[model samples]
Target: MRTIGVLGALLLFVEFVGAQTLDSAQVSAIDKNFWKTSLPRHELQWGVGCPLLEEFIIYGMGSDDLSGDFDRPHNWFDKEVYRGSRGTTLFNWSFSYLYRVCKFLWVGADVTYIGFYDVYYDKFTHQKAYINSDQLLTFMPKIRFSYLNRKYVTLYSGISCGIGWVIHSEKKEVNVVTNWAFQATAFGVKAGTSWFGFAEVGLGYKGFGVIGLGYHFNRQNRQLFKRNSL
Candidate 1:
């Protein structure tokens, strides 16, 4: 429900927050002298890379149940049982698309996948309870409003929300678990530079906190004097 609202908002236009360093004359001067020439030959709109994303369950509830009667001490037989839902790791990767809604601001739609893997040795059985993980595919479309600063760097803030699905199933003994599916949500801030392109990290609970790193690419254009009528 909330996801839909966020998606709608992201689809709309956004404004960047920044100090008006360029006066009207300076803006016009740059518009005539620099912007028109540079913009036409800037970075390509489409780029592909391994985008780092941090995923957490903003809110989730799942439990495991065992299906067997244990009247005696020998309950650990060659049978099937359900284990409760343990927490998931919040690190993954997503492909990004900078959807330009404003000149300095662009909304990025990220498709991210995170697999929760747990491998531990049982002290009693001396066997491994392979809590094999499920992979989640998220369609996180976010809105970013940024200021391409005077120094030609980008400073931005993003707010995103999306739908999450279990693209790949968890295999217990190479079988998918018959468990209820869980969903998630996220939002964050970013800072860009020349040395490393850009660094984006943020917080939004998906049953836990999310932390991520995204490498910016195709960075070329900087000055935009004219009001982008888009």
Candidate 2:
């Protein structure tokens, strides 16, 4: 009787253990629960995201060369010019289009807008400058990978590419015309309550870093296979 009772208990324990719930958070990364998807990988993650940190190509696009061999230090701090180019720093933002491949990865494009700043300081002028790129509305296709998928908060890294079709506005004061495309590298962390409020910082091209904050959005009331807009 003792042997039989012990055997029965062992069987009962196995049954109970098998019926227990798996950690849905961990599993939801690999599987899916209530939330949606993120992009590139093309699964289901719907929320907003941004590149809190990034470097832009504008800085690296040219070597620091401004004409004038006779230019000298009018102040204590002056940098030598290389070519016809100076440094450009940029800030970027992208709305969330969560197309998930799995728990660890997402791919989508950002409606990549930039706040342009020139990076130069001097005893001549200890001031930073913010300039507008001739092209402001561009698209950046990005990939986000989460280190730990914490529903409301996840640590992620993003890389993106840029392209633009722009017609200058009167605010620009010049009729700039043509197609512009930039290839950039960026990575940053995000922290948020919902998809709507998050921030990040990372390096991009042109030897500069960028930071931005924006809300994440759900891809709802919209059709599947709608495709990322250019």
List residue ranges in candidate 1 displaced over 4 A: 1-29, 32-90, 99-101, 120-124, 129-131, 167-196, 205-230
**Model 1 lDDT per residue over 1-110, tens place:** 58765753453323221313433345756653453334222221221222222223421453443444465447556435334344454445454556544344466665
Q: How does candidate 1 fare on TM-score? A: 0.50
- Per-candidate Cα lDDT values, in order, are 0.43, 0.42
- Listed per candidate, the RMSD to the true structure in angstroms reads 8.6, 16.4
Model 2 alpha-carbon miss at residue 224, Å: 20
Please give the distance, in angstroms, between residue 85's alpha carbon in candidate 2 and its true position after superposition.
18
Residue 62, candidate 2: alpha-carbon lDDT? 49
Per-residue alpha-carbon lDDT of candidate 2 for residues 84-188, written as tens digits (9 for 90 to 100)? 223332234434354665545567775655434333343234444322233345555666655545545655555555665443332235454434443232334
Q: For candidate 2, what is the TM-score?
A: 0.41
> Which candidate tops TM-score?
1
Listed in order, each prediction's TM-score against the native is: 0.50, 0.41
lDDT score, candidate 1, position 144: 61
Weakest ten-residue segment in model 2 by summed lDDT:
44-53
